[model samples]
Target chain A: MEDPMPFGTALHDRVRDEHPDLDHLVRVATRSGTRIRRRRHAIATAVTASGVAAVAIGVAMLGGSDLRSGGEPDVAVQPTAPASHPVDQPPRTRAERAHARALRALQDAPVYVDSPDWRCDQPLDEKFICTHGAASVVVVWRPAETWADYQDPAKAGPETFISDVHGQFFATVNAGPDTTHAQVVEVGEALIWAE
Target chain B: MITDAGKDSEDFGDFVRATGTQLYRQALLLTGDHHLAEDLTQTTYAKVYASWRRVSRADNPVAYARTTLLNSFFSHRRLRRSGELPTDPTLGRESSAPEDDPETRLDLLAALTILPPRDRAVLVLRYWEDRSVADTARDLGMTETGVRTRSRRALQRLRPLLGAELTERTM
Candidate 1:
């Protein structure tokens, strides 16, 4: 037998070598592409509307503030989402390019849990790990997923409670060994949509 | 490529036209269901569309979209399942002709059908896509060691049916 023979040759021979009628697949994808266009339109509108709303809110806050008095505004509404990407480790491979994008998405995540007073960090690629005291919560933000409402509570496990803010993100709370179920629930309730 | 909105719109169509079929094929290999594959592909497209501005800036847009498709499979597969793995005859039969080793093919498909999602993903990325172990680990957000462990476990499950050389090496 050859040393270090190629891996999964049988699989490639079966799946790759074969030429099936895949024409229908293109048609299916094209037909479904319209839904994506609609979603794109809706998201664009939300983004624009949110932009306008932000400007208005910013203007209002600016007008009400006594900045002319040379003092900081009390009870300041946060201008930036607190989620950030502190992991500056450059990707080592081609696939890590996508991993890097996921890390960026975590920083741009719209929702954040404020009650537990957590600092969200990307210890992995896609998910954000937010820690408060002994507990840590996992937050995964799919910015483009503005229409998919598919939620799986079973995947939450006995230790975690999930805030499946459908179409935007999923937050898995109560992650650390010392975190309690109630702490997770509290975090879930305190989630703020910073969009 | 500093494209305006009109060009970006056209570019996305071209992007989908170019990559949709391959993505669908890959999804089929992963899910073993035509409908599920279509759903996975569409969802992937929609998600990718929403992130087009960022995705378009990727070094390799095709690979980025492919990674999106794999992640989409993991994210949404559980939502559409009926708490049972489908054993329908149409599970993995995209063959164009009768196989000389039809029994072996059947056994392999059967083994694949029973394989866990992450294991199957590791196998598909490593084998069907011909990605490196490092690439597969990066794509799946797993360490290289974790990918090897999963690959071994996955191959072990298929060993009874496939007796593949890769499984032999891992064993």
Candidate 2:
């Protein structure tokens, strides 16, 4: 038998001989010509319409009170029922429950904890201690309900902020330096690390 | 030499005209069936057209299309749950046809069928398409080292299936 041939040369020859054809497959690109042109036109029209709408909205918002007559505000104060609890949200975790308890316990009172080092920058709750780093910061807890009551002077005495962290509502109270404290606060079920 | 704002249909047509035949041939080599090759080519182009705007902007549109086509083949196999391998009937058909003395073309195709989908694709990209490791890696969504390792393993696997003439020669 003859000597065996070189694999690279043989493979190269084979590939060169068997290279795939190109012209026929592009036929569809030619076939869909009309549809493509129509698509481009539609895209252009949509973009122009969006630009016009944006300009109109910007002008109206900027015009503000000047655009309206000296008439009563159109704010409607209809009493609508609160939305039902969402069914899609997953069940709360253990950490989340603990966070809620911590937040509710320190609404007005200053709760404190100390830590050496921490990784995350943002505060977890009203009082947060950096267990990982020597750094720490105090957060202010301004409960929305309490703030609203304060704004409405007609309402009764100082509203208490201390309560169950309402659905994903928690705060961080800002205390003086030299104290590294973190308060594990929760809102409904969501947990936050206030420092 | 077409610009981004070139006529969409004409550009797509040009792209297909430029690359379709080679893609069909590659599909045939991979699947070892004329009908399957045709279907693969049609499906590949349909997808390419669907994303033509994005793909055409890529540094190497041909490479992008090649990856899309090969990935489609693997995905099709996965959906069929045929263990991602050709059934015995298809294998037998591929082996039986064009059998006389086994030319290099036949040898390469046969050896390729025995390889796993990814390996087969690696060989197609590396040797057949003349793509560099970096280009192949980008197309396959793998690292350059990954492409090299896979290419080496595929070449090793193919050696046994090839004739002594091909097996003995250094790559």
What local distance difference test score does each model get?
0.59, 0.51
Interface RMSD of 1: 7.4
Candidate 1's C-alpha runs over 4 A off are: A1-7, A17-31, A54-58, A61-195, B1-21, B49-57, B80-99, B164-166
lDDT of 1 by residue, A105-145 (tens): 33345555443255554222224456666565555444445
Q: B89-152, model 1: which lDDT tens digit per residue?
A: 4433323233446754554555576677888889888877878899999999999999989988
* TM-score of chain B taken alone, every candidate: 0.78, 0.71
C-alpha RMSD of each candidate structure in angstroms: 12.8, 22.2
lDDT of 2 by residue, A23-114 (tens): 55555433332334454565466456555555554555545554465544333322121222111221276444444334433432233222
Model 2 regions more than 4 Å off = A1-24, A27-195, B1-6, B57-59, B80-104, B167-171
lDDT accuracy of residue A176 in candidate 1: 48
Write down the worst ten-residue block by lDDT for model 2 chain A. Answer: A79-88
lDDT of 1 at B146: 96
- Model 1 has a DockQ score of 0.16
Candidate with maximal DockQ? 1
lDDT of 1: 0.59
